[model samples]
Target: MEAKEKVYLAGGMESDWHEKLKQRFHNKFLFYNPKDHQLDASEQYTLWDLHHIKKSDIVFAYLEKDNPSGYGLTLEVGYAKALNKTIILVDEKSDTNNEFKARFAIVKNSASAVFDNLEEGIKFLERFSIYVG
Candidate 1:
């Protein structure tokens, strides 16, 4: 049997998006969830994130105006891009100003695919899993 693709989940910690993503992609992908790891105020958290990003086939990130966006998320996205992993970025940019200037170029261009809605991105990933798996 073919191995399931690994997805490094990176995004806002405030939301339950991780659970939602897992529910949707459970059969098709395996996830490296940061929440399952014990990440305190230490360098080990960053190390773990980088390690998982390196190991993943896809980097799924979610960013919105309501949720707190941080440099850590930007770092993960850029690293995924550098590694040439399939990047699926869900950007809910409702503002006319477009606040996310450099979420590592994710708002405009960095990701392999960008979506306005989370469900849309999930659908794309489902199809992607079918083709790539």
Candidate 2:
């Protein structure tokens, strides 16, 4: 049997987007969800996120205007980049110049590629055989 890729979903859990991604990619990837764990503070969440990122084959990050200023997600992107992990960034927000500038740094330096939507990102991963039958 082929083993599913380990995809670390890095983004804001405050919205339902994380759950949507989980449901969409359930069969193709084994996800390490921070929402599933009990994380109380930055320190705890940081440790948990880093641990999983280290084990993951890819880091799929979703960033939006409403969920902007994601310190944890930013940190995860940097860490994943440093570790040479494949990073697929889904930027669903950034309508203003400031937002675009803020996201530009991470997108340029950390992301392997960027997408306007989650479906596009998923399609990009298909080349790696990450889509389910």
Candidate 3:
């Protein structure tokens, strides 16, 4: 059997978004949620997160435009870019027209694909991503 693709869910820890994805795609993909690996020290998490990022096949980053100051999300995107990994970015800063206005420059430039919201991005991934069915 082919090995399942590993995904690193990178985003704000303010909600259960990561859990929802894992629940939705648990059988199809293996996921690494940073919150599950938190340590007492910030530096420890940095190293741990990088290690997981290296191991993952795709970095599915869901960054809301209103919550744009994420150091970990930024670093993960840049590192994934350097490593030539697949990156699916959701930059959710939308207008009434549902046009995405918010973006992180580095993540946007590095992303293999970008969407205005998680649902849209998921649809793209399910349709086009090598690992996601």
What overall lDDT goes with each candidate model?
Answer: 0.79, 0.79, 0.80
Residues 1-133 of candidate 2: C-alpha lDDT, one tens digit per residue: 5788888988887888778777876677788888888888978887888999999999988876567566667888889999999999877665445656675675546799988777798788666653444
Rate residue 11 of model 3 by lDDT: 83
Superposition TM-score, candidate 1 onto the true structure: 0.86
Off by over 4 Å in 2: 99-103, 130-133
TM-score of 3: 0.85
lDDT of 1 by residue, 48-85 (tens): 99999999999887776565555666788889989999
Clashes of each: 0, 0, 0
TM-score of each: 0.86, 0.85, 0.85
How does model 3 fare in lDDT?
A: 0.80
Best by TM-score: 1
Instruction: Please give the ranking of all candidate structures by lDDT, highest first, separated by commas.
Output: 3, 2, 1
Q: Give candidate 2's root-mean-square deviation (CA, Å).
A: 2.2
C-alpha lDDT (0 to 100) for residue 70 of candidate 3: 62
